[model samples]
Target: MVGRGRPPPPPQVARDEGIRPRRRNMEDEENMYGKLKFNMPKFKGEDDAEAYLSWALKVDKIFRIHNYSGAKKVAMASLEFEDYANTWWEQVVTLREEKGDPPIDTWEDMKEEMQARFVPTHYKTDLFNKLQKLKQGTKTVEEFFKEMELTMMRANIQESENQTIARFFNGLNYPIKKIVEFQQYSNMVELVHQASKAERQVNEDIKYSKSKQMIRGGLWTPPPQDRQALLVVQ
Candidate 1:
């Protein structure tokens, strides 16, 4: 014989038994994620797009872990808002009304609308421009490369491994640049490794030069009486 309908939900473990304790443990495991406090940022407008995307990813992860059903996940995520986020929600509603579109009933649709408004073509262009001109200036080599990496991500510039290495190599300071050219580095890792060594050596040389100058104090001139003695010796 087989069951005709779905089984009843498990009860709490009031009297501990193998099945009841297991059921209670399972329930606790399922609900554990609910204890987490989501410190999501409130989106104001286009300028808040990055923060919104980050929060959206966090919410997506949490909802997935808790096994929220499609519509339920969407509904719960929509409700999980800080007070300041209300303004952005209102703006979305107003925009939808102006477009004469049917209400956005799904989180996916809302995300799409948010992207359409915020992640404009010009934003990518600006990121691309920044990446193109990025150089290792007063910033350390590591800091400069990190900025380049971020700009590349924002611009969605998917270069080949070799091309990325080349780009990074080109932006290095003259001394490091000269050394990097002669080395047959396979990828960015090797490039960065060699560049880091070169940069450290250069920095050390500069520090050593400064220390040497400090020891010298001033021009190496004989003292007044030493000058007279030197003249007699000459």
Candidate 2:
């Protein structure tokens, strides 16, 4: 009965302790999700299958704790990760709400949380991956050009200017991501117009590959400029 005078000891302490373990459990649950990668298919359902598929997933990290008594609060936080052609550079976006203020936390917590995030991806396009490898200094320019040319020859569509540009873009030292972007353009005009700084070089590189293919295949043709050349691109 003598301890009864202690004023029932603050109940917030007990509540906070109880919440911590549950929050940790939630963190563990999030880790269970792991990570995944998604690759955009080249040419809608061609060369093989006739099925369309999209990759998606979602998770909630509700166990985040909040503290108002000095340095033991968990603010609202959310993080998202996405993948590209290569799993090596998966995308992760994070948003946090903390103590009704901007995110504030210790280095340890930030480091641990960063290390905890999981991101996995794969090489969706072999040629694209090769291009990235060249950009990363992992592959040589010659190697990239070789595979790119082969891919172009194999995936040759329309056998027109667009396909030629795609081939040159694929062979460049630029990363696969940008090359894919160029290839996705609506038409040769858009492609040429929308091309990035790297893409300008692509236009010139295509000339080399175009002539090589012509010689190898014994295919020859003149420029599409005839009597309608009173106005030039210049």
Candidate 3:
């Protein structure tokens, strides 16, 4: 063949010797997370499970559980107070508020203090009896909560406890999807004191449904005079 001297051996063989791995292509690899976009949040309707979940989250965040949901209320209230109660007393132990220095740091310090400190007392007793009605199965979690003392909101439990309860309920597989009202997942938190012991300053008998802010620290004073409106802890 008079073409080219060695005629390029074979296209494949020639290419192999000349080609290198096209250099690792770092550019493509560096880009991973994709684009960010702005979007509005969404809210589910009354029957939607998301709605209940949203309510549950709201409930879990509150400090007190005077809600209509009986033992459930007590449980939630208790859970709310637990961590705060631990830290609050630790601050008190130093006795002197001089430097505002933290006195306790370790888990052991907390544990010892917990044993030494008395749990705060409560005033509400009937909330327990009201909760017991659940055993009769005559009413749903929603209904019992709705019927109980002063208006109430849903309450949540600790994460580990919450998951455990969720697993238990899910195991039951009790036609929960069909029932409009039920506790799909939740844990119980008990109260540190009698419900009555927790006081709000309002002289007016504003039900939980009526009250916008659940003020736990003594009587409420209105307007510019009320520091709560302006105060941001951070």
Each prediction's whole-model lDDT (CA): 0.73, 0.40, 0.35
Which digits, one per residue and each the tens of the lDDT, describe model 2 over residues 1-234? 538556765545665888999999987766664332323232121222111111111111212222222222212121222232122112222234323444435423532343333211232355345544433234444454455555443333246776656555544455543665635566644543444434445656777877887788746554568324634643
lDDT of 1 by residue, 1-234 (tens): 446796866768655576887898888987787776655344445465566666666766665666556667555665665555566677777887999977777667767766676677587788887787888988887888888887787667987987888788888989878867777777787788888888888889877776677588944555699789989999
Q: Local error of candidate 2 at 199, Å?
A: 4.7
Off by over 4 Å in 1: 1-39, 46-49, 57-66, 80-107, 217-234
Q: Candidate 2's error at 24, in angstroms? A: 43
TM-score of each: 0.64, 0.18, 0.18
Q: List model 3 lDDT by residue over 1-234, tens digit each.
A: 556665545545655554444433443333321232212222222333334345444544441322234444433323344344535543565563566766554433433444344322221233334333322134443333334312121222224655433332332213332231232222322110111112121113345524545366535555564566557532
Runs of candidate 3 exceeding 4 Å displacement: 1-93, 96-102, 106-119, 122-127, 133-141, 145-234
Residue pairs of candidate 1 with colliding backbone atoms: none
Candidate 2 residue 35 Cα shift, in angstroms, is 35
Error of 3 at 176 (Å): 15
Segments of candidate 2 deviating more than 4 angstroms: 1-73, 78-111, 117-218, 221-234
Better of 2 and 3 by lDDT: 2
lDDT for 92 (candidate 1): 72
